[model samples]
Target: MSIFISKEAKDKAQGYWFGLLIPLLAGWGVSTFSMAALMSRDGPVSEMTYVDYFFITGWISGGLVVHPLCAWWVLLRAKIVGNAPCIKGAYMSIKLYILWIFFLLSMTIISFIWGE
Candidate 1:
């Protein structure tokens, strides 16, 4: 409502440990699974046994950081992905939702126009 990142998003960004715990755990789970699969594919690495997992953890953290930023971006662009301040919500909304569709559309258009 106000520029970008409403009170809700701010709440999420500044959310309690429990709020962040979900994102962190979501990050951990996705990272762990992806790491296992990728490491299995790449065979073994003497350099590091769980490097892929580290990568996943990095990615998950990135997602957590990006989620709130994306929320802010939505506000500036008026691209609403309803209740998509979290990973799970964004995943679900991306499949079937006007807010997400609009946001995706805006990004595509912007990419085509700005080459970003």
Candidate 2:
């Protein structure tokens, strides 16, 4: 009985971890690293404030939300129109990546204008 219960709990936990937690954490990590790298490109980040950190993080989080939805939409449209899934997904992903780069640039500009 204990073994059965343990297995059941593990199965449920796997679903939650894979379906939600993994993606959210991956998004957070990617956003954090990307923002930090981009910010450091202009100069050293020895004196950044909490507000600056949050601003960069928030912007990347917004991008993380937008990027996947937009990609899914593209993939859906491709499926409806009878295009190849692999090709469409790849193309859309690349486009979204470019947009992410653009987003980073815009964020950098905003940060500079807003000041340290």
Candidate 3:
């Protein structure tokens, strides 16, 4: 094994990390925080107004849509810069996206069960 890493390898690694981190943070992190904040409000879930419901739906659904797009964009940019291919980044993004979905679903269920 070579001790030194090539620039291309480094770029690809960076691209992969960015693809994972950006969406995970921007999409999952923000949505999770927002949802938690909304849920943690003074009133019960049943007391949430239309606007609150709209925002909750928007945040979760929007993250589902937008974050993957963000990942794709990042991967595309990396490819354009001759760093990495889209495959690995895309795979990572999809995995994270799935996990995010499950998390949101579980959170929603838990909130509904005990959020009185």
Candidate 4:
């Protein structure tokens, strides 16, 4: 179980990691430049562009709920929910990602203009 499980797990991780890399990168880039980022003080996080995504979005929502829940949803769809549901869910997940980037932007702008 050890080696097999390890390899399979790595494969699965790589699959998801690469699968979402573009969306992640796009989201990060847009979020960094779009509006007043939620947690941005006066500069980019860590002076690294990608780190901005990893910190604000990752910590605020991704770490708290999005990443784990999406992983579980993906796994549940794959293992238990069957193909159709998985595909449908995956499509919606991508759409949700698009809308979410917009939502974050709107929220940041509103907060900046309106306060609190």
**lDDT of each prediction vs. the true structure?**
0.48, 0.57, 0.73, 0.54
- For all candidates, what are the clash counts? 0, 0, 0, 0
**Tens digits of per-residue lDDT for model 4 on 1-116?**
45546865666555555434433444445445533554555764466566555555544554235543554456465556344434444555566676776898899999999988
Top of the candidates by TM-score: 3
Candidate 2 residue pairs in clash (backbone atoms < 3 Å)? none
TM-score of each: 0.26, 0.36, 0.60, 0.32
What would the per-residue lDDT of candidate 1 be over residues 1-116, giving only the tens digit for each residue? 46536776665543333233443355456556665666566554655557565665655644444444443343333324333334343333233234544786899999999987
Q: Write the per-residue lDDT of candidate 2 for residues 32-75, one digit (tens) a residue.
A: 76676566655457967776677676656645674465455555
Error of 2 at 12 (Å): 1.1
How high is the lDDT of residue 81 in model 2?
58
Which residue pairs in candidate 4 have backbone atoms (N, alpha carbon, C) closer than 3 angstroms, thus clashing? Answer: none
Question: What local lDDT score does residue 47 receive in model 3, on the 0 to 100 scale?
Answer: 79
lDDT value for model 4 = 0.54
Q: By TM-score, highest first, what's the ranking?
A: 3, 2, 4, 1
Residue runs of model 4 more than 4 Å from their true location after superposition: 1-58, 61-82
lDDT of 3 by residue, 15-80 (tens): 667767776667776578667767777887777888787668857755887688777777777667
lDDT of 3 at 17: 74
- The whole-model C-alpha lDDT of candidate 2 against the native structure comes to 0.57
